[model samples]
Target: MHKSIAIIYNQPAASPYRDRNEQSAEDGVLVEVAAVEKALHFLGYLTSKIPLALPLEQAFSELSLITADIVFNLFEGFSGFPETEALIVEQLEALKLRYTGSPAAALKLALDKAETKTVLKQEGILTPAFQLLDNATLSDFKLNFPCIVKPNAEDASHSLNVKSVVYDYDALKDMVSEISGMYGKKALVEEYIDGREFNMTIMGNNILTTLPISEICFSLPQDT
Candidate 1:
């Protein structure tokens, strides 16, 4: 019998940024859902699309009703609530359903930049020193100048922009305040690494294989 799959995802909405020319950050989820649905169809598996949203119990009920053998688990979270991304996986686990991607605990850890850095440090991995700051404790930040500030629990550069990098204490405070106020979360202030950057994609659980590394080159100025 052919296996069935559910292409779950967080549906894309209008771009929150003022620049209308830019696409929505959630667009990738839709793209992945479409691509996966098509590929599974070609492979002779029945597929269904499940767009996750508010009233998650309703979504969960729908998921349970679906006869799919497994879920692709592309749901990233409802709009403006990136921190809830892991909850979707948690629900899947409760349902005793098979799904793809990282587990809920891993998802939660990866979402919190400060906690992730702490774990990495404990493992003897070289990670930049960082501090988690909120409006109540902004005055306590003592990191070196030229630090990068970002939403503590958000992914996909939710509130990150050119202004995320700060050169002075005032700029750092302002950026941290902006992140906390806008994203409604603590800000992660980390020492900025002034050097080339690269992205390496690792796959597989038992035997991890690193894909080709791609160097990140910014066309804009260094301070931008």
Candidate 2:
């Protein structure tokens, strides 16, 4: 018998503050949803796509009604509500539903980049030196120039642009202030390293499978 699978994802919220970059990021999830649905069909599983949005009660109520053997959680969550991603997973757990993707604990931990970096540093894993600035105070700035500033808890490169990368204190201050003012959160300033970017995807829980290393090719200017 083919088992049913529920594919849950966050319905992108439209906001005046969301620019082209943010919209682009949110839109990519639609592509991901289609790809996952196709893959599940090929695997001979009954599939359903559930798009969840604001008003947490409605989302949770919808979740309680799911009748699937497994859930493929593709929820990247909505802006300003980063905790929603983990909360959905937690709900699944409470209902004792089998689901794909990381657990709520891991999702919560990974959402905070500063905390993730601190964990990596404690584990002796080499990571770029970063400072978490809550109020744009550079009085204790110790990192060298050529740094990138990002919202402490945001994903999908939201609010990131050409100006995100800075080479001077003035630019750094501006970027930090922007992140704080826009996201109402701390800014993460990390030492920038100019080079190609790569992603290593690993899947599974009990037995993990590491996929091929994927490199990100940039066609834009070096500064960008």
Candidate 3:
């Protein structure tokens, strides 16, 4: 007997981007979904592709109707509404369905960068000193010059661009206000750490396995 898989992913919509020329990260998920579905089919598993959209109740109803043994869990939530990503996972839990990827708790924690930083600090991990600005008021700004500002709750580099890095207080204030006005979220200001960045992908639950590490080589300016 073959195992059935439900490849659930977000149906992307037009969203605001700091760089208009940059492709929509939300829409990019479709390409990933297609690849995963193809691989599953090639491996002889019965796969069903379900694209979810806005209105959480409708998405939940659609999920509730799934009969697959497991879900691929590619849903990243609707554009301009990143909070729905974890909410969808919570619904999956309520349905008592096994799904791939991180749990709702982890998703919620990761979405809030400030909270994640706090957790890291508690765990004795060394992270850069940072502050969250809910508005344009920048009294007692302590972060050094050449700091970077970004939307507090966004992922996929939504409001991040070349201009995200600031070298002065005026530019920092402007950037913070830009994030608040455009994304309607608090701004996170952190001291700029100029150095190499790498990403490590880990898999599994009880016994984790780390994949090959990849380094991000920057060809852009230092402040970018």
Candidate 4:
């Protein structure tokens, strides 16, 4: 029997903020959807593409009409509302549908950088010293100089730029304020390690397999 799969993904749209870049930074999702659909077709599985949009109810209504053995969840939430990413997974769970990638709870936890780091610290994992700050809070400078400030609950390097790294309390405060004002969310200030950055992706459950490590090389000025 051929299994049916639904490729659920969010179509890129323009943001309301005029100051923000209007060009769809996430246009790559279209390519990803095409690639996944093609691969699934080659694998002999029936596939359907579902493009999600705002007001979620419309997407859910469309999903109700589809019957698939599994949903290849690619929804990364609307452009600005990153918090809704986990809600998509939760909806799938509520409908008793199996989907790929992290579950709703894990997605929610991971989205909150400070909470995720706290859990890691409790588990004795080595992590940089960090603090969560909102618009009204002042920086205590708990972390060392050359710290990085980022949105607490956003991914894909949202609201991040060269100025995100600060070398002093004043710079940290300005960066934190800028991030909070821009993203309208709490900022996570953490110690910045000025060295090589590596990322490792682990796949599978029970029997785990690690993918090749990837490194990021910066070409811009270090103090930018």
Query: Higher-TM-score candidate among 1 and 4?
Result: 4
Better of 1 and 2 by TM-score: 2
Candidate 3: residue 28 lDDT (0-100): 86
Off by over 4 Å in 3: 18-23, 220-224
- Model 3, range 102-145, lDDT digits (tens) per residue? 99999999999999999999999999999988564578688778
User: Higher lDDT: candidate 3 or 4?
Assistant: 3
Q: Evaluated with lDDT, which candidate comes out highest?
A: 3
TM-score of each prediction: 0.87, 0.93, 0.93, 0.90
Q: Which ten residues in a row have the lowest lDDT in candidate 4?
A: 16-25
What's the lDDT for all of these models?
0.81, 0.86, 0.87, 0.83
The window of 10 residues in a row where model 1 has the poorest summed lDDT is 14-23
Predicted structure 1: lDDT = 0.81
Estimate candidate 2's alpha-carbon lDDT, on a 0 to 1 scale: 0.86
Q: Order the candidates by lDDT, highest first.
A: 3, 2, 4, 1
Which residue runs of candidate 1 sit more than 4 Å off their true CA positions?
13-23, 215-217, 220-224
Error of 1 at 194 (Å): 2.1
**Candidate 4: residue 176 lDDT (0-100):** 83
Global lDDT for candidate 4?
0.83
Instruction: Give the TM-score comparing model 1 with the true structure, all chains together.
Output: 0.87
Give the per-residue Cα lDDT of candidate 2 at 171.
91
